[model samples]
Target chain A: LAKTTQPISMDSYEGQEVNITCSHNNIATNDYITWYQQFPSQGPRFIIQGYKTKVTNEVASLFIPADRKSSTLSLPRVSLSDTAVYYCLVGGSGNTPLVFGKGTRLSVIA
Target chain B: DAGVTQSPTHLIKTRGQHVTLRCSPISGHKSVSWYQQVLGQGPQFIFQYYEKEERGRGNFPDRFSARQFPNYSSELNVNALLLGDSALYLCASSLVGGDSNQPQHFGDGTRLSIL
Candidate 1:
């Protein structure tokens, strides 16, 4: 399992762009970077995933540098509802279960 | 289409008691995994089953066990529960293949509180 390190918490205001970075220095070659968002009393929701470079979707974008040691999740134009805990997971290949670290809690202000 | 479903939304058990949590995966999904989420921490993987076979096990103890049915449903049994066993037990289901690429759909989870 590849361990991930992220901020403990972050604060943002409405209409602002929020960028959360995760560091996985020992990430494996076959590992893919994935992000999940969990709201209060709910399961974690998939945000974005990428193997390398940049991957964009309707919700957010994942930017992975060439080294693949770190990745950033960019949420454009945040809102109050965007407040949640974001988790960065490194590996899920084959039969491997996802090991989640202490996620970064994003508190969106009105 | 219905997503993953877990039974006994909330449960309370004694320290020496045993408990069983059930999970029903989404239709057409063949992989089911269990996780334990303690307060103020991210969820930790406990077990993963594919096609009714035990595929992987996490760093949990022997007291924590799980099995998958032919229908792809699963049951997590914890024996001799303790206060530390109290947490949100989550179950996630996904299609078996490129596990990294396939996203797992999660249930609301069973909130277990041990006295």
Candidate 2:
């Protein structure tokens, strides 16, 4: 399993773009970066995932550099409902459960 | 389709007692994983089962045990519970192929309060 580092908290206004970066210097060859959004009292929801370069989905986008050591999750036009803790995970194997870090709490203020 | 479902949304127990947490995976999902989330912290993996076999285990002690049923439901059992054992128990389900890119679906979780 690869360890990940991320900001503890972030503040952003509505309609702004928020980017949260994660560092995984020891990322394995088979490791893939995944981001999840967790609201209060609910399970974390999958936002986006990427192996390298950029991958966009309906909810968010994930960008990974060639080194695979770091990645960022970009959320566009945020709203108050977007306030939640974001988790970055690095794992890829058969039935290997995801290991979560402290996660960055993003507060989308009005 | 319904997402992962956990039973007994909330439970209260005393120390030295045993507790059982149940999880029913989504339809067609063959893999189920368990996690423990303490307040103000991210969830920690406990176990993973696929095709009714144990596929992975976390660093938890032997007091934590889990098994998957034929229908892909899972149960997490903890014996001799301590005060520190109070937390939210989460269950996630995913489709397990040879690849590891499968996204997991999680449930609302079972909140266990130990006194």
Query: Which candidate comes out best when scored by TM-score?
Result: 2
Candidate 2 CAPRI-style tier: medium
Worst ten in a row by lDDT for model 1 chain A: A90-99
lDDT (10s digit) by residue, model 1, range B1-115: 9989999899999998999999999999999999999989899989999999998899999999999999999999999999999999999998877534676778989999999
Pairs in clash, predicted candidate 1 = none
Cα RMSD, model 2: 1.1
Q: Give the per-residue lDDT digits (tens) of candidate 2, residues A1-110.
A: 89999999999999999999999999999888889899988988888878999999999999999999999999999999999999999984436889899999999999
lDDT of 2 by residue, B1-115 (tens): 8999999899999999999999999898899999999999999999999999998898899999999999999999999999999999999999877765887888989999999
Q: After best superposition, candidate 1 residue B76: deviation in angstroms?
A: 0.5
Candidate 2 chain A lDDT trough over 10 residues, lowest sum? A90-99
Worst 10-residue lDDT window for candidate 1 chain B reads B96-105
Those runs of model 1 whose alpha carbons end farther than 4 Å from true positions after fitting are: B98-100
lDDT, model 2, position B27: 94
Against the unseen true structure, what C-alpha lDDT does each candidate score? 0.92, 0.92
